[model samples]
Target: MQKGSLENHLFRKGQEPLGWELRLKIAIGAARGLAFLHTSEKVIYRDFKASNILLDPVYNAKLSDFGLAKVGPINGNSHVTTRVIGTYGYAAPEYVATVP
Candidate 1:
């Protein structure tokens, strides 16, 4: 995390924009991280945002802050019902409506 959060590199004033290649790499890395959490770990990442995505010196994206994470549905359950929690404007529309 030498580069800190991706949000800092993205929205801080006077910083150059990340190029398309780097952006794509970050996106892919983030997606892979999420996928691993969902599939292998069976965890629901309730707080996924730019501020939670840390970057290394080489710009590899890594997820951080699992405080809001929850164990996913198990057995025959289709979903887990829980109180909605996450940063404002970051929740999906379906998630906000259904809390699934």
Candidate 2:
């Protein structure tokens, strides 16, 4: 529980920056986690951001804070309609247009 968000590690002074390989690994892990949510779990992560990604001591990444997540549209539907809720500048253009 003491592990901090990726943002902390990235921006904190006096901390060594994440190496290229470790950064790549974290990116891949985050992608795989998001992919699993979108495909296997039918969930859309509306709040993907550095602050929402938690890292362990070894730098393994895991997504956290699903308060803004929503269930994906049912099969055969092009998109689901819902009021948009997430950090500003992070929402997709389509999502911004779709939200009232």
Candidate 3:
């Protein structure tokens, strides 16, 4: 079944705002999905934000929009250099700084 992004639920007008319990659960679920990506596959989700998280009818959260996801650094390198691209203010501050 088709589902909408978390942003849709949060920003839709005339609808009751999501309760704190659901919000907390969504946050925890999103974090778990992200943690799996990082620990299981070493993926860096560069575009992690509300818009990229979709919720099912029961409000189960899942990460989407993998276009910006990157394989993390290998061989013990400190970091990987790449073009800065992500929703403004959503990406971490250090990620937005252009590296020479």
Candidate 4:
């Protein structure tokens, strides 16, 4: 990742703000990556955040760090019940409140 993490580009001190077009491009790329994992691979990426999205020199986004990934529900099960885990601030409020 020549550009390093998206977080660094977006939030790190002294980094320039991303242009609107670049932001949209990066966002779409990241979404596509997550969509592939969820739909094609049947995997849940539990840690999805700016820091987990790496960018190439052209600002193409790629997902990194799958340490928290898990196999999605199978065998006709609609969901999997597991303790909530991931970065503290990144989880959806509804998910955090209802998962337990």
Candidate 5:
């Protein structure tokens, strides 16, 4: 963990569309991290996206800020379970819809 900032990533600051390689790398890292949290640990990520993912010196990703986590699932874990509470844009689409 090199403790780099997530805000520096191309997505966080919205520094325009990224070159395919950098963009793909970020997506891959995020998905890989999410897969681990979702299945490897049997934990569903109530919140996901660029803002919550920090980077190390080498740009390796580290999932950070898990305040909204739940034992089962965050509000949007279901299609009709409205109970939204997450950052704008970065939150998963399903989760965002839960806003009430």
Candidate 6:
């Protein structure tokens, strides 16, 4: 994302008015990135939301903050993370179930 490009949430505000085409495209890009992470890479993006979607000047979206992400489970050990992480209202439903 660019240094000063509009963020997904701020752009969504009616008063902000980030033209329709750009918004839609940004949304699509964000979805594709997430899909790549989950299906193609067999990973779980435990956190996702408009705020975390950083957009460039051309409305290109990028996923940020993978530092907390863990690789897919290999051992029989539980992936039931007890960390209780992620931003509110954007955390995956499955994550909440796994955590204490």
CA lDDT, candidate 6, residue 26: 78
- Candidates ranked by lDDT, best first? 4, 1, 2, 3, 6, 5
- Please, what are the lDDT tens digits per residue for candidate 4 over residues 11-90? 88999999999999999999999999999999989899999999998999999999999888799876565688888889
- Specify the highest-TM-score model's number: 4
Off by over 4 Å in 5: 1-3, 11-19, 73-81, 89-100
Writing each residue's lDDT as its tens digit, candidate 2 over 1-100 gives: 3568888879989988888999999899899999999999999988999999998878889999999888887878755655678887877888778766
Error of 1 at 91 (Å): 1.8
Q: Which stretches of candidate 4 lie over 4 Å from their true place?
A: 76-79, 97-100
Candidate 5 RMSD to the real structure: 5.2
For all candidates in order, the CA lDDT equals 0.91, 0.86, 0.84, 0.91, 0.67, 0.71
Please list all clashing residue pairs in model 4, or write none if there are none. Answer: none
Q: Is candidate 5 or candidate 6 better by lDDT?
A: 6
Tens-digit lDDT string for candidate 1 (1-100): 8998999989999988999999999999999999999999999898999999999999999999999998888897766666788986888877688654
Q: 3 or 5: which has the higher TM-score?
A: 3
Query: Which residue pairs come into collision in candidate 2?
Result: none
On the 0 to 100 scale, the lDDT of residue 17 in model 3 is 87
Measured against the true structure, the TM-scores of the candidates, in listed sequence, are: 0.86, 0.80, 0.81, 0.87, 0.64, 0.66
RMSD of each: 2.6, 2.7, 2.5, 1.9, 5.2, 3.8
Cα lDDT tens digits, model 3, 1-100, are 1558888778889867889999998999999999999989999887888888898878889999999888877898755666777888886788677645
Off by over 4 Å in 6: 3-15, 75-83, 92-100
Better of 4 and 6 by TM-score: 4
lDDT of 5 by residue, 28-59 (tens): 88889988887767565776756677777766
Model 2 CA deviation exceeding 4 Å by range: 75-79, 92-100
In model 3, where do residues sit more than 4 Å from their true spots? 1-3, 75-79, 92-100
